[model samples]
Target: MPADENTAAEATEARRGRGGRGERGGAAARRAARSGGGPGQQLTYVTRKLPVYEVLGEEGIALIEANADTVLEEVGIEFRGDAEALALWKEAGAEVKGERIHFPKGLCRSLLSTAPSIFTQHARNPERSVQIGGDATVFAPVYGPPFVRDLDGNRRYATVEDFRNFVKLAYMAPNIHHSGGTVCEPVDVPVNKRHLDMVYAHMRFSDKPFMGSVTAPERAEDTVAMAKILFGEDFVDQNTVIISLINANSPMVFDETMLGAAKVYARHNQATIITPFILAGAMSPVTVAGTLTQVLAEVLAGAAFTQLVRPGAPVVFGTFASSISMQSGAPTFGTPEPSLVSYGAAQLARRLGLPFRTGGSLTASKVSDAQAAYESANTLNSTMLAGTNFVLHAAGWLEGGLVSSYEKFMMDVDQLGMQQRIAEGVDLSENGQAMDAIREVGPGSHYLGCAHTQANFQTAFYRSAIADNNSYEQWSSEGEKAAHQRAGQLARQWLDTYQAPALDEAIDEALKDFVARKKDSMPDAFS
Candidate 1:
């Protein structure tokens, strides 16, 4: 094709890509750019504009902190089979009794002072860099689900293709800030080598900041190496590029794998979210206070250990505790107990002065039904009010996190935009006051034809992409599709129309070659 014809086609595609879900991050710059509208054009990062709602009073906070200290000193926590970690604990002035390390009253808290309260997680595209901690809340999609569901209502094991599609959808969803780690577990890919593919997909498809692998110590190392290739090793060492998740085994246990991964990330000054996986009544005591004590102790141990690995290493104090159904022994979602735990955990994290990570749009419904909507709404509200800094599973989570629904992904993305609007709070600026418009339209006159109303019409009201606001007769005339169905349509349309952010050819080739070499060196192990 001729140069002119090719440019015309590119412009057409760019136009078709416009007018997506919500206001993009850099819309004016996107329109002025000569190149095609790429993912880099719009990076929607949410900064919390609302005040935090504290659930625990000062006395409650003091009591919890005191109890947490007692648990650490008297009860102690176990570092199973991690001789190196135990040795480090011993060197850090903790009393080491075999694998169990007992801290003195304020030992862990003293060590936590080394971790930075806030840091930037850089993306391949610098515009998409995210500030973790303080007043920012970065929204990431559903992570680590082994199964996937499509628009056809089919449920099955996720494939590499499905994983790539999810990446594309995440890239397309402007509301999602980070391309999270393991958007879905690609079952078709060998267990030993999926991280390579996952990281490569994130690097290639999206320009957003993404999570690093923590499945194994070596996997975390591979993630760093790949990041070095994308963003030079010197840049990566000085700047926090990837934030990895390190889970602690509940009931006061720190597994070797999570510790090893944290060690690797901390060694390079990368950020790690030291999280405690708690299920009340099962992994923890049924009461919120008991669970809060355990959550604090576990994070203090894991996060403090990261500081031991490298002082001033960036780490997020994370909480993922939920209640369980006693009757069926099943995990519940969007319940009161989890909200209380999340709120209290946020207060505890603030008290310790560390960045916090929690869940979003959490639900246990098998499909994207009424239960999914209400549950997700409740979860999102609690997370926002709790002032979360990094939100994982912000969208598409379903069936107690066993599956990621395509429709729900879109639905939750829309809701996330709504949350961002809500967090912005009511504007009080002169323009926002609308006094002139009110005076101009006073005395039996409508504001619809006023200049202020016309001026602010585009942005004055929150526009929903998947919501149906038509009359009942008009909705029935248009087939009366439900919210989930409309979301499915938007999901499919986004996938079909998705254009991956352009990467330099040399860098893209180098990343692919590196992934291939790493995969070839590993044996296929499915366990």
Candidate 2:
């Protein structure tokens, strides 16, 4: 079912602080606070232990140092963005060819030394959840790919209405915590105004921490400015509310826009997540080692910029990357390379003492199908096992993350629950409820009528939603629809029925004025 009434009511209760058992009193809160999970970051599966790294143990540090040397020497990265980066690398005993710069082994070691392992992402909505250090996972809204299926089912280019509607849908979503939106369809906001809309969408629809989609240099500056304005001047400088994610163009490139954005965040000691999306056998070499060499080079290059721009910037070594398909020659989302890369990334990120951003629910298919489930589940499993600190696309991605499908959105929520169950790891700390209940009636005991079952049932075991636990006859009669159908329906209903939180009159007016001024300056973008 598409977010049944119980789910809706549960959501309501959660908003009002009543439904779940998340609340904690004095000692528990203090203990939880003392935990390295961080005040802003809460692990959904707190009891579930991820495989921790021994970065400085034995020869691990030496291994990382060796790897850095290899990356800079043999697996050297080439940059094709600003001449400044090239000049810097060339001065550091590197090669310079036009805009492309080959990083030296010494530079890589120096750069890698400055990165960190765990950091926090604070939300604008104090009530909303933030994540870091593999403690919690994040679900981002769909983006990029153009075109939509109209009411009559004809595929056509998307418009501003489509963007706004998608934005509205993202804003209305119950489980998703961040709104990755400019939400203005193909109407196309000017490169700069896109940042404004993204910031504005977060301002209007969510109090949650949102991603700033700054596609270029000027836009990145605008984005940082907006954050400083929305929050206090010291806010972005302090890694609160807004955290900037900069993707280094793979196969040796650091566009000015990305480098510029990294500069802003790094200068402020705010968060900067450097990622690379490489299409294997295409943009990257076909072989895994070749891909890693190229990817590691990009990482080091970004690390160099980050440290050079400002030392000690709160940076995340994100492996939000995927490989390409050899057959179709397009990017492949659901594949083994992402998992492998994510694992290696986690190991490397740990060495930096920085949090890792890994993959999740990524797929090549456009809609929520059986293909979607298989791919997403496998990806999630791999990332979680890899001890990834932060998970992107944890929930709600469909049509290869190009188009948002509500059906898949809610299903992802359910999938998250399932994954959390894995982390729950049998719950041996359930006060021995299972055995006690079993012993309550001896070997032949019937616990169904026992007080243990009556009182501690909810905490005693694993539960499933997408999977049927009912009798086979009942399941057969119900006519099973894949989780996608259920998710799609939920997305539609959320768009149609869910209401956004009220905004302050003054803030709303200011936002409207901001949009108007921007729109006037960039009419070409107000699609």
Off by over 4 Å in 1: 1-43
lDDT of each: 0.85, 0.59
The sequence of per-residue lDDT tens digits that candidate 1 reaches over residues 283-360 is 999999999999999999999999999999999999998899999889999899999999999999999999999979
TM-score of every candidate relative to the true structure:
0.93, 0.79
What is the Cα-based TM-score of model 1?
Answer: 0.93
In terms of lDDT, the poorest run of 10 residues in model 2 is 13-22
Q: Which has the greatest TM-score?
A: 1
lDDT of 2: 0.59
User: After superposing candidate 2, which stretches have Cα over 4 Å from the reference?
Assistant: 1-48, 52-68, 74-76, 84-98, 112-116, 134-136, 147-175, 181-192, 430-433, 459-482, 525-527
The sequence of per-residue lDDT tens digits that candidate 2 reaches over residues 1-527 is 12342343234333332111134556544443323121222333222454542223436445545665676666456565577667666666777767656566577657656655445455544445355554555555554546554333344566655565565655444334566543334534454455566566666655556666546666666666666555546445645355567787776667787877777667766677788777677677776556655666677678767777676676777666676667777777767767776666677666556677767677766666778888888787887777765566666555565654445555665665555556645546656546766668787657788877787554345343344567878767877644545445545655675445555455466656866776677555433
- The lDDT leader among the candidates is 1
